[model samples]
Target: MPLLDATATHPITLPDGTLYRDTVYLKNVISHPRMEIGEYSYFTHCGKPEDTAEILAPYLGHSVRERLVIGKFVQIARGSYFITSSANHPMTGFTTYPFRIFKPETFGYKDLPVKDTVVGHDVWIGHDAAIMPGVQIGAGAIVAAASVVARDVPPYAVVGGNPATVIRMRYSPEIISALLDIAWWDWPVEKIETNLAFLETGDLAALKMA
Candidate 1:
């Protein structure tokens, strides 16, 4: 049996002529409408990616609408799960029982203010990582495997561990600044191909000249 339906929708193609489906290591069970995944950004669900809208009142003091925005050229490894709004529950109640969720007529849904989880361009997320909601991962950040990201990650920083602390920066401060200014991820396909050598060689002079 196929992992995804034959008629399932796919919108992006990678540099090596592979569809996003080919790179996705897990099952594509749901179509995410609340997610705005940009060019070349992909995820592996481990066959259990979260895409639910129902937020239990116990988990959340109120109901919340989840949104995920991923930017271009992002690399996501297998077994990575994004925590959706459904998983973010209230933390401060005498009893965590979400009676309001069961009895909507008796208690109307309360709205919880949850911001979108934003992943910036050229970021790399390693295997089995769990990214929490409302976290903003900056451009060119590297998330180590098995990490649980709960906060904002700075641009070009490498982070790891349960709470995802910064391990190091990918490059020197000057280099990071230069790379961010270059914004190669935003370059056109033809330009990227043309300057691929400079990118591959770390030849800043060549890139600048081009």
Candidate 2:
């Protein structure tokens, strides 16, 4: 049987061949206009499949200017959520209270600068991780559980803690560059399957040859 099915909302089949309802392919479940999700990006949550976008990013409204862009093969564990630019209060003022929001016609704060949140391909976000707005997580990055990521993460970095800091780079600069160049995630599924051994084993030489 083929390993990946892009159309399957519940993609993970258990050992007993029963579908796991807690995980869903984000692309198949999410239909938000402000969000752009790549194929095979799965989000593990206990919420309804149709509410995946809302649960993942509660503050990203349909009318919001900023977008949530998630790339392919990303694995997001349960309890992880994104705090988009829209979630920000009027921090520039003396009082953080949003007085303008009380009136229907004067729902201000539209002028607040908003930036998109981007998650790169093959990233693994751990449980209860909180990604702040405008943060760009590079491909193959691993965000530790309960992390609060406020800054951009480099490719293949392992980050942890509040205001997440890079714990370490998964590979040396030379190897990281080569992997980025290889970009196996962009390859056809069949080709990827054929080279799965190299990917799983971290055989860079073999992958380069593939």
- Give the candidate number with the greatest TM-score: 2
Candidate 1: segments with Cα more than 4 A from true spot:
1-22, 25-31, 45-64, 104-109
| lDDT (10s digit) by residue, model 1, range 1-210 | 322232333434568977664343111333445656666555543232233211101122223465777787677776676775555555566865656666658553345456778889988999888888789999999999999999899999999999999999988999889988888888776777788889888998787777
Whole-model lDDT values for every prediction: 0.68, 0.96
Deviation from truth (RMSD, Å), model 1? 6.6
Candidate 2 lDDT by residue in tens digits, 1-98 = 77999899899999999999999999999889999999999999999999899999999999889999999999999999999998988888799998
Instruction: Judge candidate 1 against the unseen true structure and give its global Cα lDDT, from 0 to 1.
Output: 0.68
lDDT of 2 at 99: 88
Q: Give all TM-scores, in the order shown.
A: 0.74, 0.98
Off-target runs (Cα >4 Å) in candidate 2 are none
